[model samples]
Target: MPRTEVPPVLVTGATGRVGRVVVDLLMDAGVPVRAVTHRSEAAATLPADVEVVTGDLTVPESLDAGLRGAGAVFLVWTVPPATAPAVVERLAVSTRRVVFLSSPHRTPHPFFRQPNPMAVLHADIERLIAAAGLETTVIRPGMFASNAMFWWATAIRADGVVRWPYGAAETAPVDERDVAAVAALALCQDEHAGGDYVLTGPESLSQAEQVSIIGDVVGRRIAFEELSPDEFRRETEGSWPRPVVDMLLAAWGATMGRPAFVTSTVLDVLGSAPRSFRQFVADHATVFIDPTPSR
Candidate 1:
């Protein structure tokens, strides 16, 4: 089919870390793009060619406009589960396929097997999508590399010393851009229907090692100070949700002796090696560096 005749892929979470990249990749490939955002102001952040529409996942009726002529939907569920069935039902009626951004809860690794409310939510949503019978692909990306910026950038920028628990716990932090690329491919091609992929970085690195990689990129030797799980909890008590802190502590503690679950899925699907942790840090080195100080 010609580009003009291609039905737009409606992207939920259109301004998010992954969905925004998915929007751009789809547009680059000549597929028409329809982005769904809760706030209409988010349209200014997207490409001018993208058809931005207002939609809220919690209110399934609000999605009708964006789903009206969409061929596929990139579903990013960050809301409560109350309306998933209704939303999936609407997608089944309006779109031919859906690419859901989910987590690797079913992976048998000890790290992934920990009790996670988010995982339960992801599994429930997956079941709903299966029941809906839309051509579906599940993209599960382990630890996003950008999380380094979220978790440690403040400390790194301040003093270059990270105080956190489970410094030796290992994980392969996948790049969001790579995750988005695979999602775009799945959205544009019918062959990816029913495909399930778990994406990870090229190598497994410990939390301390990940910090060191960032330090290396920024030309500084960052100190890694391990905190007891209790100390971490106390430190982040009011700032971070209790459940999230517990979940991370459990996963990291469980995987302390084991290497992270690494995968070749990114290479298998994209025909290129996934970006390494060092490369990811290099690309965003400025985030880890303090701008006010001279290097």
Candidate 2:
């Protein structure tokens, strides 16, 4: 595992929300990037400067082209569980370091005590990465600010009323850009190796408070109505996977009477406070504006 002055870094899930930002930040730091995706045609969408290559992490042999000459890798596991061992093992043999984007499992809080299938997968992959003797940096980001779009965008667009369960459940939502920035730093520098960074925004605010902040930023009064667990389950059953719904309900329920876990890893790593929820809403406010016309 020889280090170079400026080695090419491989970014898996290059086109995804956080991955795209990671790629941009890495490139801005003068690091050559190799963006890996399963679909070769998707390469057209990435920047012309990026070396877009087709590679499937689950299929280790498929990663040959993308892994070649790369000193570090940004791994965003988006595949089935069965192939994780092989993928991580292959990564260990291919690259000098791996920066994995994972959830906040180590946070000592009720909100993270639930049984999440994704967290299970992340743990398994992390063990594999360590067993392989690779320099690994695990970034555990708390609730994402972008979650507002999935949870309340439609209601905000329609009537500006967010009807949901456990509005009192507090969370320190970290912006995806901050997550990406820290990840990019890990990939480009040697100092971040062996670091387990738990990232979150500066403030710990409840769901209702977050919505109110969004309303303030968006220039209106958005109402928050707490829904019953049963109602939330019923509404999301047909749309969201059962396990996912159960996980959210349990996490939110557990955090109802507790404040979310917050950490200053973002500031420690990037030397600045992470983006606030209000800024997130202000930037993407158009998405929450109702598109339909009514009489």
Candidate 3:
């Protein structure tokens, strides 16, 4: 738990948005890191000193090999029940502490409480880990600021008009970097066991308002248009799961009528302020900037 103790950290989802950041942070802090991924090629971007292990979380046998000698683990639940038992079992046997990247289901807001099936899935994993007797910390992050890149990056780069559903629905979008920072701290230290931290940005903003901040940062004006829920569903059906679609629509609907919840857990844990939406936009603007403009 002290700053002087350094543990070998195994980070699952090592190539994902937050996982990669956690890996980098641990390495920067001089902690030994074992980056776990399904493909070794994905580990190429990581530091050569990092121990890259190819293992499937769905297989308990594979995890023992990847987790051998590691003292702490960072778990990101990407799949369903098929892999939960095997993964948690391995971590319980091998690791001293585990930090779970999860969602805020017990938040009591209709947005978070909307009979979410996926919430049940995460809850199941949480229960599994707790029963296994490992020191556990749960991080529930609100909507990520990075979601905008997937939702409107193409449109912003091509037509410069970002169209989506519920433009006025409010959300306190947490930066993925902040989430990763907290995860890194929890993984490297043992003091945060049994902590359920709800991570959020400093301020709440609507989708339209977030876009306006992006526009301001880029020194350009961007337009936002709302789509009917049906139209939005049809457009996004191929990309989003049905349950996730329902969850988002319900959350957005609830948000339209009420103020979003903003939390300072990132500051409380990491001793610094969470990044603003404007900061996120500025940091990732290249994703939306036009690659080729008309001559």
Candidate with maximal lDDT: 1
User: Which pairs of residues have clashing backbones in candidate 1?
Assistant: none
TM-score of each: 0.97, 0.94, 0.95
lDDT of 1: 0.93
lDDT of 2 by residue, 171-290 (tens): 998899999999999997899999999999888999999989878877778999888999888988789989888999899988888778888889999999899888888888888776
TM-score, predicted candidate 2 vs. hidden true structure: 0.94
Q: What CA root-mean-square deviation does each model show from the true structure?
A: 1.4, 2.5, 2.3
lDDT by residue (1-295, candidate 3, tens digit) is 7566555889998889899999999899888888988777888987788999988876768878878878889998786678788778878778879999989988877678776787898899999998999899999999899998888788887777887888888899899999999999888667898899999989989888988887887777889988888988998878888888888888898778777888889999999999998889899988878867679
Tens-digit lDDT track of model 1 for 177-280: 99999999999889999999999998889999999888888899999999999999999999998999999999999999899999999999999999898988
Regions of model 3 farther than 4 Å from truth: 1-5
For model 3 the TM-score comes to: 0.95
Q: Which prediction has the highest TM-score against the true structure? A: 1
Worst 10 residues of 1 by lDDT: 1-10
